[model samples]
Target: MTADPVVETLDALELVDHHCHGAVTADLDRPGFESLITEGAAWPGVSPFDSPVGLAVRRHCAPVLDLPRHAPADVYLARRAELGWAEVNRRFLTAAGTGVFCVDTGYAPDRVTTPSELAGAAGAAAYEVVRLESVAEAVAAGGVEADAYAEAFRTAAWEAVRRPGVVGVKSVAAYRTGFDLDPARPRAEEVTDAARRWLARGGRLDDPVLVRHLLWTAVDLGRPLQLHTGFGDSDIRMHRADPTHLTDWLHLTAGTVPVLLLHCWPYQRQAAYLAAVFERVYLDVGLTLHHVGPARAGAVLAEALEITPFRKLLHSSDAYGVAEFHHLGALAFRHGLAGLLRERLDADELALEDALRIARWTGRENALRVYGLPDGSPDDG
Candidate 1:
């Protein structure tokens, strides 16, 4: 069968990966690469091929490294080791066709590229999204007294966001205390006491009161707040990470700032429900896309879009520690989403123009709008 024209058009559009983390700068032997692909947070000795994402790497990413498609996992790792880090990064990142990467620099700071290095490898521009948990941890580690922790965190956050290239802030509240905290901003004494208790206990910042404080601080700053919600490695209490749990806080912070929900899966429907009802909320099924791979990406996208307003959906890889994810994510989102819209066009359910319009909106335009990037859509002048 001839390729669908809309699918071809999608491949040409430049994507703004609105949420992602830095790629590894090191050369990986087999195990090292496997750890990056899985959500396990470590090399667990189990074969990476056992997971969908790992299988996806062998099937789709092998060719990008100059091997045959569906290359054996062992063969794939050997070819990758032969190519070395820089070449592998250059090949996959440049091929991803991403025009911008909004990078979160907090996670694995030493192991991954800085935002600038990532831009250089991909031949694209990048911006930073400060991670709140990292900043709070730094403050606690600096010997800030409990009474001073609140101001210390605010000052640090302000300085961090003001640094050149930072466009937003992110919270790992889901991974820390979950969204089940008090909806109201904690009282002054509550914050001070909570800081004292946490600090006394070596200051982990997972204290519910302090987490709520960090989130509210970001909201008050008025920059976008990217919250990790649903399907994070084994660290999260999956049940408590539900976006629906944030409704009270959502109501509290409504109209203060945009809350971008990252990595929603198994709860895309819940996320879509929140997006449908809350003007300040937006979501991406990035974790779902990369893990499920291109073959099944459409079904997830379809579910997310079922009750979501078109404008509220955004694209992200949520990829961390690898450039292969950067490539597969963009490829899957563009290819899979376009294929879904193409099916509708063929059945007379959607016009050709409508299909192309939706493809451009979801893959490129929505991110530009949500992240406040220039609309420079060709039609915009």
Candidate 2:
């Protein structure tokens, strides 16, 4: 079949992956690789290799390492090992065809690549997105009095966001307190009490008041704020993760800073509604796409774009640990988005020029505009 001009345009465009994590720098065995491919636990007698994302790695990423399409899982892993970690990373990262990466520097349990390292591997420009909870937790670890906690966190967070190459901030409140909390910014006394009790426990930041404070602080920082919304690891409470719960909060924080809902899945429609209604709201089906793979990616993208304004949608990989996700994500986005736009063109519901423009806006332009990033050259990656 002759590919449409829309497909060809997306195929050649260099994506701006506005949200993602670093890939593991170390070589992995079968067990190690399998664990990173799924959001759930690795069960006895069950293999992630038999799953959708696993199959995608073989289909899309195998050839990047000199293996044929649909190579057996054993064969694919053997080839990846032979190529070594650096070479594997380079191959997949370069194959992903990303022009820029906005990396979340927190959440490194392994020796993963840094933003600069990831950018260098792909020949792309990279910037940082500071994690808000990590900063607040670090402040607690350093020990501050209850009355002083709010100021201390704001100070530390300011320093973190002011660091070079930081383009935005992120909050994992979905995993911590969820979006059901009071939308009003917590008062100073409320913050002090919450911090006092939280410091006594000395653990991860799951306190609802503290979480609310962290979010409000992001607004104060005045950088784009990325929130992990839906379909995450086992830690996520799916019901609370729905982006619709954020409606009241969105209303309270209107026009302050961009609120980017990341990895929205089942709630893509709800997210679309928010994006349509809120001026500062945006969303991306990032981590969701690569996991569902190319076959189902269109359906997911279709739902996400149902009520979403074209300019309000953005592209991301949210690829962590595995470089295959980096490549698989870009591939799925290009294929799925191109297909959707092409269909609209065929139905005369969209003019060819409008389809092409939407393709550019969603794939690269929207992210650059939202994050205030400069447009990257075609030679960037």
Candidate 3:
């Protein structure tokens, strides 16, 4: 007997990971690797398998390394250690079923792959997403005076987007100061005063005016702007990261640029609501997918899909620290999305053709249209 047609089709989808970070190129011990899988910024000091994302690695990722299904934690880690980082990267990355990667290279600079290196390992086309903070820090370090901070940052940002591989820009305002900051653009005096304080002290760009100004600059450039929202590591203030806090800014920036919201978890529905009402806003449930694993991904993705327009949802792994996330993230998404869509098809809620079309749109077409990539071949699987 044949298997379910809906799931079979989803298995063949070649997704464009609209947002992600490069994998670590260095070798890892069990704890080092374990630290990567969990959502926290620091190592948990205990075994990672006690968590959802950890247990998921044991159940789903063990086999990709030639270990048996649900291999014991110690055994899986041992096998991973024996394989070394190179083989591990190639195996997991090749298994991810992704054709294009819009890579954000600003995370863990010393330990991670470059966008070029990432593309070579995954056998996919890779593009860059410049982090606003990285560019700002560079300008500050160049000894540009605070009075020139605004102009210097603007010039640096302008030059960054003009680079060969850059396709978009991202802000971690959710990580720094959250989305609760005043939505109005700060006046030039406010920017200069804030810049002076930040530079004279520790040279860190923590000023709210500067943050707001950076976001507004991205809007002016009119490229896709990625904002980290909702759940993250310990660094994020959970309550302050809610995307609903972005309502005022989204309203003001409407029609000026495309804003991509990343990693919406407890706020997935809220993000979906925003995407539904705002023409320029879109959302993704990445990092969350792999953490929830295939079994629980449906509930989360269903929440995101409930109000999100089909064209406004895109795919991402948000994978970092390890390539296993790159593999497992896509696996969990395929399993979850296929299962949910199949149930609807069977219950007569959706037509066969329409179901497949939505699957294609969320998996790739949406990202290509949003990020302006030329359409890739269908067999990218």
The best candidate by lDDT is 2
Candidate 2: worst-modelled 10 consecutive residues by lDDT: 372-381
Residue 244 of model 1: what lDDT?
Answer: 89
For model 2, residues 244-311, the per-residue Cα lDDT tens digits are: 89889899999799999999988999999999999989999998898899988989999999989898
Ranking by lDDT: 2, 3, 1
Candidate of highest TM-score: 2
Off by over 4 Å in 2: 1-3, 376-381
Candidate 1 accuracy as lDDT: 0.86
Query: On a 0 to 100 scale, what is the lDDT of residue 120 in model 1?
Result: 98
Please give the lDDT score at residue 35 for candidate 1. 70
lDDT of 1 by residue, 1-381 (tens): 987779788888888898888888888877677777877744456776777887788888888888998888889888888888899999989999999999999888448988899999999999999999999999888878888889999999999999999888999999888887788998889999999899888845699999989989998777889999999889899999998899999998887788889888889999999999988788998877988999899899989988888778888998788899999899889877987887777789888888888888878887777667766332211
Better of 1 and 3 by lDDT: 3
Question: TM-score, each model?
Answer: 0.95, 0.97, 0.96
**How does each model score on lDDT?**
0.86, 0.92, 0.87
RMSD to the true structure for each prediction, in A, is 2.4, 2.7, 2.8
Q: Quick one: ranking by TM-score, best first? A: 2, 3, 1
In angstroms, the error of model 2 at 294 is: 0.5
When summed lDDT is taken over every stretch of 10 residues in candidate 1, the lowest stretch is 372-381
lDDT of 3 by residue, 47-133 (tens): 678788878898889999999888998898889889888889989988998988899977774488888888899888899999998
- For candidate 2, report its TM-score: 0.97
